[model samples]
Target: MADTLVADLIVERLERWGVDRVFGYSGDGVNALMGALRRAADRIEFVQARHEENAAFMAVGHAKYTGRVGVVTSTQGPGAVHLLNGLYDAKLDGVPVVAIVGQQNTSVLGSAYMQEIDLLGLVKDVAAQFAQQVSTAEQLPMVLDRAFRAALATGSPAVVIVPHDVQQQPAPEPAQEHGVVTTAPEWRRSQVLPFDADLQAAADVLDAGERVALLVGQGARHARDEVIAVAERLGAGIATSLLGKPFVDESLPFVVGTMGHLGTTASAHLLGHCDTLLIVGSNDPWTEFYPPPGAARAVQIDLDGRNVGNRYPIEVGLVGDAAATLAALLPRLRERTDRGWRDDVERHVRDWHALVEIRALTPADPVNPERVVWELNRRLPADAQVAVDVGSCVYWYARQLQLPAGVPAHLSGTLASMGCSVPYGIAAKLHRPDRPLVALTGDGAMQMTGLAELVTVARMWPRWSDPRFVVCVLHNGDLAEVSWEQREMEGDPRFADSQDLPAFPYAAYADLLGLRGIRVDDPERLGAAWDAALTADRPVVLEVLTDPAVPLLPPFPAGAAKLEQMRTGLQQEGAAGRHAAELLETYAAQEGAGR
Candidate 1:
């Protein structure tokens, strides 16, 4: 038998790093690694994916659910190129994923071989770290260590490219071990300059003021108690950003609601009217809450000092963890002299909830996107994991779906990439097969990136117990809702009507995978179909046909400006424009139909 190659050693190192599964597709250049994986099949399982994008997405889902580094591999050239989308998603979400890509043989460096491409240069901007393997036996361990450490340290994706020939080379007599430890930078508890005085000053401001409001962000993930404590101390109303929604239970007394474009009307009212706005750990970049020219005065607290004054001019900028800062400021906070303001804010939130009920729940001829989300929220178990894609679905879920306190909900790129739902759903199912996993995806998004994963899920079902991956596809067959709104503002009333597309039978696609598939056209059958899928002890897909006419008003209005700019750039009808225009029309139609 030939001596164990460097690829075997690399696999051993991956095992030591606690990686049990690696998601990717196999190809010629990566044959050595595949051979090693086959030899060590008992130690680590290689999850062969239909697409490299799904592999990266699966890694993201795994990292989100397990809080551990996710691993993926791909072949040279086109394979590695396709992984970039998912890698970007991992970077934007602060998820740790290690990606290994196969490269041409070492001798072919700069020779323009068939599969030769600058993999490192391709991913340098997005990857936290990148490495190239020189001689497999001598350099594999060092490169792997560097990649793993960089991924864990920054909570981002790391890429490593291995040459085909080098991977098959035998190790030297004494293999060198690279020892690198990954650790997070210590977050010191420090009070900002004059923060104590500022707290007292803020308290005084609140003492005189009648209404107070609190806004929380992702930085407040673990500071739920501190937020509630501060809200209780000041008798103030509490609201959260879309990312911060899971921090506090919706049932809390002071929980006003979410803030932004898609935010509750009551929460927006409280933010607009409050004399003193306490922003805890939010960048507050969304313009729907803080529009230009006129907004309320605010006190912002964030660990990163740079984010403090970037949005709104701050009355007080406190630098520290939200939990610690809020805890320290709690003692200095005083109850508002007039309790009527608090009462008014609470009433506004209630009224806003009622308004949402009317818009989302009123029976319409076609299914309401809001009704589907509300029903899913009601039927899902408290601990069920939800991975939501971008576009109208995100808007609907962010505003309507109330996640149970502490349950995990994964969103795609903070950059807001489409087609992340299926991969995210697959990863969630892989990580927590026992827990019910749900994906809320729009037809456009599902078709864009995740359609291939349906086959991957079917193939992997035998390995998992009760692979209850439920996907509720909101099919609108058009993307005109947002586009129509934008056109209306541009003096083109007919633009919305021009963007419409034929609907694909998504149920047929699901059925092809031999999975339970249900199509729902009416609002009434949506609940029953969703419930049936969730209860089914297998992978199920529920295709709910929603109206494409409903416009998706995003939670943050600031994002709309960026989309409008994109729409303008792609207004022409060339290959790129036609594709872009088609997507936009489909998205708008979905939104309009839902409305």
Candidate 2:
């Protein structure tokens, strides 16, 4: 029997770091590593994704849903390259993920051997916090420890590159005598909070203003009660970035919906009217939606100092954990006696909800995409986790779907990458197979990556405790988001060759995969379809043929400019633009009435 290889040590280190699974694909460059994983199968399960990119996405999803450092592995060259998209998602969203990449043998350093591309250079940007190439077996433990530590501390992607020869080398034991470093796999969260003076300053900002607005991002996930407490004390209305939507309970009467181009009119009203703005744990890039620079005095609280005062100019910045900072600041905050601002917030929220219902009930060519997700609001399971992809479906999800309180939902936020829904759904499911998952995606995204990831779902569903994985596809036969963007953003007519999607029977394909499939075109059948999917014995794909002409309406105030732009663009399209124009007019009218 040969001595245990360095690859074995790597797996052992990961186990010590509390990693339960690794998502990846294999190739010759990682043959030894794969063998070690097989040997350590009892310790750490290896999840084989259909592609390298999906594997990386799974890692990011794991990090997001579990609040642990997600790990991914890939072979040399092309496989290493394929991990970029997923890694970028982690970096941009501030999720922690560690990538273990295989490299060509060190002996072929300058020879340009097969799969010889430089791995360190490729990952440096995405994995800026930490990226190292291990040349010796003794370096593995330290490198792995630092990678995990950096990933967790910085909340970003980290990469470790091991050459084929290095992976095959004998595992090294602890060296006690000299400069060689040894490490243990451990990380803990610090109770981080800002100085007392800063907290008072932040509280002062909230107390002095009669009209205050609160913006929550994913960072405020654990501080739900604290956020509500602050809002109540300040008599402030709450708005959320799309990423923060799952963290806060949208069912709260004064809580307006998401903020952005796809956000709710109520949120636009709250932000526009408030004199003071409090941003918690969110670095949302929707600057245009924020109260025009000088309009609102801002106070931002973030664990990271780098993110403080990043999105909006602020009167004060508190670099601290959301819950801790809010709790400490609570004593300093004065309760507002006035109820007028609170009344305004409640009114806007109620009107917005009524408006969305009206939009959902409006007739379409086949089915309204808004209605598809709107239906989920009433039927979504309390324990269900949601994963959304980028497209028009994102607009619907942002505007309509009301997640049950405490149900965690995630997506490719800052990256806005398509085809992440299925992969993210898989990660969330595998982490807690007892909980059901819901994935919302557009037909264009299914074509991009969802179709192949569905295979991954099929392969894994048999072992899940609760096999209700519902993948709802908005099969609109067009890249509706981009099509609308062309008209709304650039004033250009729809380009058929570029915008149209080739028809695919998504539900039929799901059935072919031996999973239950439900196709609902009629608006009335949507409820039944969801019921069947949630109760099915196996995973289900619910495909709805939606209309492409239903416009992607921007939120109020911003929509004022976009509405005219949309009208001009549709008019330029001649006969083809008529349906879209009618829909846009209806949507615009609804926005005006709601606001």
> What would the per-residue lDDT of candidate 2 be over residues 263-330, giving only the tens digit for each residue?
99999999988999999999999999999999999999999999999999999999989998999998
Off by more than 4 A, model 1: 1-3, 128-136, 172-210, 291-308, 315-320, 335-338, 363-365, 480-482, 488-499, 553-595
Taking all chains together, each candidate's TM-score versus the true structure is: 0.83, 0.99
How far residue 247's Cα lies from its native spot in candidate 2, in Å, is 0.7
Backbone clashes, each candidate: 28, 0
Cα displacement (angstroms), candidate 1, residue 120, comes to 2.1
User: Pairing residues by index, what is the TM-score of model 2?
Assistant: 0.99
Q: What are the runs in model 2 whose C-alpha is more than 4 Å off?
A: none
Model 1 clash tally, residue pairs: 28
> TM-score of the candidate numbered 1?
0.83
Candidate 2's displacement at residue 436, Å, is 1.2
lDDT of each: 0.73, 0.93
Worst 10-residue lDDT window, candidate 1: 180-189
Identify the candidate with maximal TM-score.
2
